[model samples]
Target: MPKTISFNDNWTFTKTDSPAYSRQTIVQGQPVTLPHTWNDSDGQGGAEAYYRGACWYQKVLTINAEDLSKRIYLEIGAAGNMGEVYINGQLAAESRCGYAMFRAALTPHLKQGDNLLAIKVDNSYNNEVYPLGADFTFYGGLYREVKLLVMDDIHFDVMDNSRDGVYLTQASSGEGVFRLDVRGRLVNEAAASANGRVLVQLKDHEGAVVWEDSQELAVADAAEFELSGSICNPVLWDGIEQPYLYTAEIRAIVQEQIVDTRQIEIGFRTVELTADQGVILNGKPIKINGVCRHQDFGGIGNAITKAHMELDMELIREVGANSIRLAHYQHDDYFYSLCDRYGLLVWAEIPYISFPSTLDPDSRNAFEQLELLIKQAYNHSSIYCWGVQNEITIAVETENTYRIIKELVAEARRLDPSRFVAQANINGVADDSIINTFTDLVGYNLYYGWYYGEIKDLGERLDDFHRTRPDKPVLVSEYGVDTNPNYHSYTPQVQDYTEEYQLLFHHNALETFKARPYVLGGYVWNMFDFGSANRKEGGEVGKNLKGLVTIDRSLKKDAFYLCKAYWSKSPFVHLAGRRFVNRHEQLNDLVVISNLQHIRVYLNGELLTEIKDGQPLNVIKAVRLILGDNHISVEGIDEQGERYTDEIMLRHVLESDSSYIYVKEEKTEHVVNWFERFDLSAPGQIEVKEGYYSIYDTIEQLYRNEAAKAVFLKYFAHVTDNPFFEVTQGVMSIEKMSQLVFYGIPPELLPVINRELNRIAK
Candidate 1:
């Protein structure tokens, strides 16, 4: 189970540089939120604001043992910057890494009364290593979560699970063999002098033991073991369709007594990468249409909920984005689990961004944090690559940062050869000789068109890279220009972060990839706008809106839908009641952003349009196809113009759901006495049919008989998933609508939505 009571919010603060006990002071604390960097109050939310200093946070926790003799533990979900935990007046646990969970046994420090859990956080900007050296912000404070746990010392089990661990590899549709490996550390509190063996067993979903093994342990504390077992007639686990998971239980027996037991989720799948085919999963050659992401969300700042993370994943899935690059650094396990459960491929990385690491124990400690990351995120199948660094050339340009990165990648390979090693793209002719040999897959984070001038033909970049490094697979790790659409600036050059350039950047880059097969994937610079301490755009501080989705997550600029279209994930229609105000050369009734040649569009149960060679979107004069809940279908005809169609259902909302419009109508004004901040851009369109996303499919006939981009008319289907509008307003979040969008109805509607959302949210 996840650690209890996340440790991210509402903690006391102090500025402490050393671990000296006297540095611990009692100060009034501000209600802090996790998933947020500490500088939210400062200008740190901006992409260009630079703020740094040491800080500490304290949380009051109720520590209780299940049994009088059981041990209690204080688990820090993840500490941003650097931090130390103290119970009452004594040291309990300490950690660095803005991401990663660590625990310290608290039984010895707990008193018979209430406890004050103080965590000292040092959030200073280091120009030598990562974040500070990178382009994003390095927010402060203990940013993740902290948990209080109580368990038996002798029988405790730490089952940190995420994506792929070990399970049955299905032979056919549902048959396969099982492989199990259960691992954990055992602590010996009482003198159980006699030695024993830790037994690991694999059980099928039916509760039958498919395999079992035991490892003799002659020690305590951190005793590692391996249990190998295989199950015939295996049940392969998949996501969305046929989501299956096997349970691996571990039992440590000492002197005929069961001392420990734990369970973990395991999926059976294999991943491979090659220069010729890019990525191969389950024996199928696959290309990654991926997006780069940072965990911090808008509105709530960093104090995000599980529902928000799932919504992010759902957005990724909805766009048919098959992969995600955990860009720049390591993120929380919550996001990882969502990716794993959904079978989305991922590239998990460390915060080795921009600059060189602070040498000495600080860097070593960072290395140790990497070990914890491996143990914590090892089993996740979604993570296909372990990224060692991002743009290490900045630090390595002077010092040998690549030397250390090479060692780390080598170590990671030794730790788990099941996945590939990816070195974050570095500039200035990085020691490619070493990286090429050490890295299984090489990635380049080129900002040629962004930081530099616009590269006329981005696809030519693919061709150039292929020609230079033809043997190794290449991925465009970072692309997409920044765009602050709501606010406009008058700049003729593409340097202006306008909505047009943002959309145009993706359009050109994606078109480039469409012509190249050696390229495995390309992730946009980011998925959503995030908070950054070091940012200044339009002369304002706080929150960088470079994301396709705005900081508040209420709006999707033209680029957001453009990306969906170029991804070849058609038949999606959002904001169907409205058409894009701008006319682009590519928009079409049946848009085909691929090299597959001919395409046809249909509407209202009849064929309507076709584009081939270089037919423009306005063959109908304008890209706007008469907005409404119109039936649209698309057929991917072969070069010879033979057809294969896909259908889509869209809901058009011209008038508000209610006739006596609450806000739209200026009637009565309803006393209009409330003043609260709101994220107007969060909800764009909500599609509905028979209450939910009713996807109708048939053999020959397709959706509405024509290709319909769902972005225009399909955001109203599941009022349940978007109930976020009621309490939060706009689209509803799952946590809010869990009850409604289920085998049941959502919560009752609330007036003054976002205000009530904060109330019920508690």
Candidate 2:
């Protein structure tokens, strides 16, 4: 039998890249454990100051004399961006795909005593990598587990993309019969040829054998074999209702002596995607109530543990979400296992996101990463869609971009024909773009209410897409707004960063998704706030606040309960606006969210109103309150006569609280009427003098001139410190500054900026 040992302790790590340091050199660094990162602190701090470079980690592995004769291998669960492994000062193996697992044989490099092992991991900006640019922070380190596998001379191949070497394909052949195809590879390192029998068994969840088969294997160095079987009336692995699973155990026996064995948990199910209907799982239609998740935690960067993953799954389950979209890249294998047990449909994607590199090597890297992602996660039954790209055309769309995406879609289908391929197009991508039609399913990251248009326009925009492509299955892959719990408002509006506006946005969005069944379903932008080093919005730096739960997992925003009311089956009532305690108006609207149909409201110990057949969101308008503090409570009873209650206290005030508002630092008094004096219609009025910079010039052109750069940065830096300016500098024209009024840039400042730039000669 094979022995797997954890190799995660007593490693020395340093953020600096010591080129001279090797196995013979002593490393001067702090001792650390596996699943660690250098960006835990700096990555969460604002201002794009996080460290993104090469780091060094070294560990000493002592091999016993008795174990030196066996086949020894070292496995790295994951290394960010890229990594290289060295044994005894010699390069052994390298992995270009940052988020995939890989292993290297250590038998040739190991001795009978201590052996020096070192790894160099880099997360720096590389055009050849898949995620050249994205919104989330890329933390650098050996952020996953490491293991040592000791096996006999003849064993299952562990070098096939770091897989289990056993591939099982399950399908429904007919009305009560299912077929299974098993493919496996083995490696024989003995001095002479070996003959063995490979036994394969299918066992139910109760550990009872349902089917078995054996195959003869004879090999010198490497060999491959296949086996086929069938089962009668196998239980189907349904959605959240009942997720049944079976186990496949494979063993290698030499002369009736078991040498090596591998076990894998498997599930049998069918998924169908249609143009009019949503996801059909196990011959039933199901809406995908999903939330997108980033594998990071507050103050932890990307060095999360199994406990952290479990907590995230608990929160997702609490919100009554039936699915999850593991955004941007491949996640931990343990997380996939959790999804399998919990029965959450998943949207697994690669990190070919945001901007596409024109380099051909980058395209090849994308293909290789997709292959590793599919092969490693092929056994998980929770994954229904393989997302190829997300917002890939946001920077610039070209012929190469279209070709790369088409090839990725084709490769994903070719690798695993059992699942469908999907892509998340940017909101601006036209309905007629060929990129949208490249994948089997299509999704759009629409933010109508939060970014550009009114909240009500979401439904209209979705309708337009459905009308244009009635034959395509469509979904909203991402939708959300940044919200801060410290801010509150009675008149909620877009970009306010208030808890009330966030609630209103999701309320309207949920209603919109429910009204249209042709539109598959939507996944919330994020389940928790995550680190974005370039962001300085919502009165916070280095974070995107578009999450139902806070990053620390301490507080659940009011929008969370609103979702729970609609999706969760638990009979409960929640009084909304508990965080917004102070109000200036004497008469205010009291809101309550509950799953129960009947709800009773009380104000200051008096009966305020009783609502029958109440919806998920109940609003009692124009309820009079006392001059000082008033108590509000809501109650609901389930069918079992168990009462659930929620209460809060609100204080009525005559004046507004300035602390509750987010005030921009720039003064707006002097620029109140500056827009009236400027003209935009007449092109001849604002002349672009020869050898001078003007609004007609691109931002890149202005930044090239020392005098023009200073003038442009003085005003624009007050609104956002996002590095997106650098991304769009060469492409976006300075005239687009007028459209930044939505982002808190004053409309009047555009002419002033152009005027100052025009004064400086080119």
lDDT of 2 by residue, 1-762 (tens): 789999999998887687654565445788999999887777777444688898888898888988888898989988997999888988888888888898989898888888889899999877678687778888888998999999999898888884787788888888878888888888898989888988999999889999999999896898898999998888877867777888999998887888889888777888888878888887888777889999989998888999999999999999998889999899999999889888899999999887665445248888888999998998888898899999887756667778889889889999888889999988878887888789988999988888888989999988999888998999899988998888889898888899999889999889998888887888998899988886778888888899999988999999999988888897889998988888889999999999997788999999899987759998999999898899999889877788999999999989988778877566475344434444544333445678889876766777788888777666554433446655555444556545433344444455666777778986
For each candidate in turn, the TM-score is: 0.70, 0.91
- Local distance difference test scores for all models: 0.57, 0.84
Q: Write the per-residue lDDT of candidate 1 for residues 37-73, one digit (tens) a residue.
A: 5565553353433456766666666644443366666
lDDT of 1: 0.57
The per-prediction CA RMSD against the true structure, in angstroms, equals: 19.6, 4.3
Candidate 1 lands at a TM-score of 0.70
Q: What range of 10 consecutive residues in model 2 has the weakest lDDT sum? A: 675-684
Clashes in predicted model 1: 71
